[model samples]
Target: MTNKTFCVVCKRDDASVIDMQPHLVRCLQCGAYEIMAIEYLQMTNQEQDPLLSAWIRNRTEEQASPPLLTSSTWISLRASLRIPNLREKQAALMKAFARRSMFPGTVGRYNPVADFPLAWAANEGELRFLKQDLIARQLLDNEYTMGGSFLITAKGWDYLDSIPAGGVFSDQVFVAMSFSDTMRTAWTSAIIPAVRQAGYTPYRVDAAPHIDRIDHKIMVEIKASRFLIADVTEQRAGVYFEAGYALGQELPVIWAVREDDLKNVHFDTRQYAHIVWKNERELEKGIYETIVAVIGRGKSH
Candidate 1:
């Protein structure tokens, strides 16, 4: 059997033999260069290779555009440009550009643990603090509290970078958030899930509570949230009021609406691009872009 070579970066199989090195092959499609072995398992695991990450960065360029769907040659040209330290710098630049492009969007590479490094808790006290925070936020939920032993919800996980341990967690609580209800049924369902997916927990204030309360908890919560979202369905009064309140608080609010509804939307509102969605897929994609914008803003600041 012939040795199979694959580009570790793009994860493609289109490779070419190199004249200089008999054992090494190049991904002609995506510019991923590598060496392989005849036995399937013998190829060095790219992730495990200490130098591979750095090498990938050195081998790839910053301006290397995203692969075009139509061209295999374009696919092969995407060099793995992410060197560890260099990758951070690249991320920062990308973040800065993203910040300028939009507000309150997702940032970084979208790590599942929301940026948790491997083997995060080496000591007991640090682990204990994480548990306390999770409980305080009601993320772990009392039903499953394991005496400072449990997992965190997405909201809880976002705070990991804020943890004082100088790890990925930061100390910032809910700096900003977005909310909207005057949306198409499909879009309404998509927005919240997308917000959560972006790693920001958006609280829906659909029903107003009793006007009198010790903390004006609902409004206060909105105030504390760093941003807001309002879906204006052909000028719903409630949506306008809430959006106005967030704007008054100087919170970064994003408006979303259907295409037909835009005709009746106010000129002032029109000036600011209301995130529009024709369908659920578009709504999710919009939300992801918004998340990137939010993350980008955070990084730049």
Candidate 2:
């Protein structure tokens, strides 16, 4: 008789077979494997087996939690997850921490155990798995403790640099404006067209098909955009926040306001040059010219 085998899914030898069946095994690691003889053969020949190929693809996808969509900040750091792999995700997370640690006025080293960005993880368990994986691979320095600090190893930096560009931040322009009927007309009739003429895609948060946390989505769009066009015609607080955030990221902000409403613009922002347009034609013409002058054709930064 042959020796009892391990779970085929996770390769754990400790898993027990169902009802003493040698062909069917349960996985202890993921608690998800219930392998039949045919399924086992299919899994082994996944490339040649269509059913097993689809199952494996689906299972691999299900491993990623729903709420943990990759963010544009990861793109800006040149660490976006282009391929679905543990090492890539770990590298992106580590690079995010490294960026925060280098931020102006940052006093201490990043403590990933305590300071892992929650926005990047779906839950505490997912975060823990990432940390443990990195530690196991010797890419991060620290024990699994509350006060433990995370310092990337030299190998970790090499891994980060090895990641290919994900191109999440393409030639895109984020448009910030009021959602009123007039502003909507302005955007659809003038702003968006001008952006396209300037050779960049324009995106507005309200136009997105999927409903998500509004602020979170907006921030993601801002980070992904090559530049920002802020129309403070109504002086909406959200518009101001978006513009200010873009400026803080050192992204170029193209300020605009209605000719009549220019007086309502904040005192501080008024210091910068702005496009004061009286009508849609003026808005379109001014924005197109400004984009051509400020961001030149074919340039993404």
Candidate 3:
């Protein structure tokens, strides 16, 4: 907490601040997050964006370490930040309720003022409106007390169950790699089976029967996939480009390369851990373990 007395993300002054190794700011509006003083001070009041605020609030609600924001991490996050559409916001808010009230008819308190970020709302008024909309739709019970508590209706659970695993990327993994004659074994013997073993659908754009524009199809498939596996074995520009697009969408990208090609990776992406393997056997095992670690085993086998 710099002596500034206002939240770095939303500029709300009433937030609780703890000056520590990574300054902890428990913002009622933006939720809790750890930020280095340097980065906190670097943010100007004009930099506030609700999408960024909502994402931080989401990380806080996950009950994991509050996401630590730094210059490097912000580059991609800031670029990826976009206002979510109305239906998406409502879906997120309902999912938040589902997280709290696992079963129907369980009351959970919501603070429109503090938890507005949960709905990706710009303010408390918007959050109130969203709540009322849900109530009107019979997806949530009306708040019973002044505390603004609510419960999901049975219909709400049904609605949630009907939705996909995520707004984007529903347990499908997009594989970005060289489709070269030498790399044939890498795709068939390594990447494909590795993704399948991790319980997710492995999709290589070329493997699909799409007569549409290839680039359009690639972009569409990338958005539909949960994460990306970028095998830079041949250091192909297409693989790097696809991985960059995935990063911009905030999808996790696992890096892999042939041991001999490891030295050829681009300078910017070199910082990430690479699963350098001597052969397809090692590549398969490495990619499988990394997928399990980065993203837990997917439900769609």
For model 3 the local lDDT of residue 131 reads: 77
Winning candidate number (lDDT): 3
Error of 2 at 229 (Å): 0.4
Best by TM-score: 3
- Give candidate 2's error at residue 242 in angstroms: 0.6
lDDT of 3 by residue, 1-301 (tens): 4443588778888887788877888887777777787887787444777777887886566443466777667677777566776777788788888887746777877776778888788878888787788888888876642346788888889988865543332567889988889999888998889888998878898887645678877876786678889988878999999999999877889999888888888999999999999988999999999989988897654
Candidate 1 lDDT over 32-143, as tens digits, reads 3433333223332333222332233222222121221212322332232122342232222222222232222322222212111111222234334544554676544445
Give the C-alpha lDDT of model 1. Answer: 0.43
Judging by TM-score, tell me the better candidate of 2 and 3: 3
Residue 206 lDDT, candidate 3, scale 0-100? 82
The TM-score values for the models, in the order shown, are 0.37, 0.49, 0.55
Candidate 3 segments whose C-alpha is farther than 4 A from its true place? 1-4, 142-147, 166-301
Candidate 3: what lDDT? 0.79
Q: Number of backbone collisions per candidate, in order?
A: 30, 0, 0
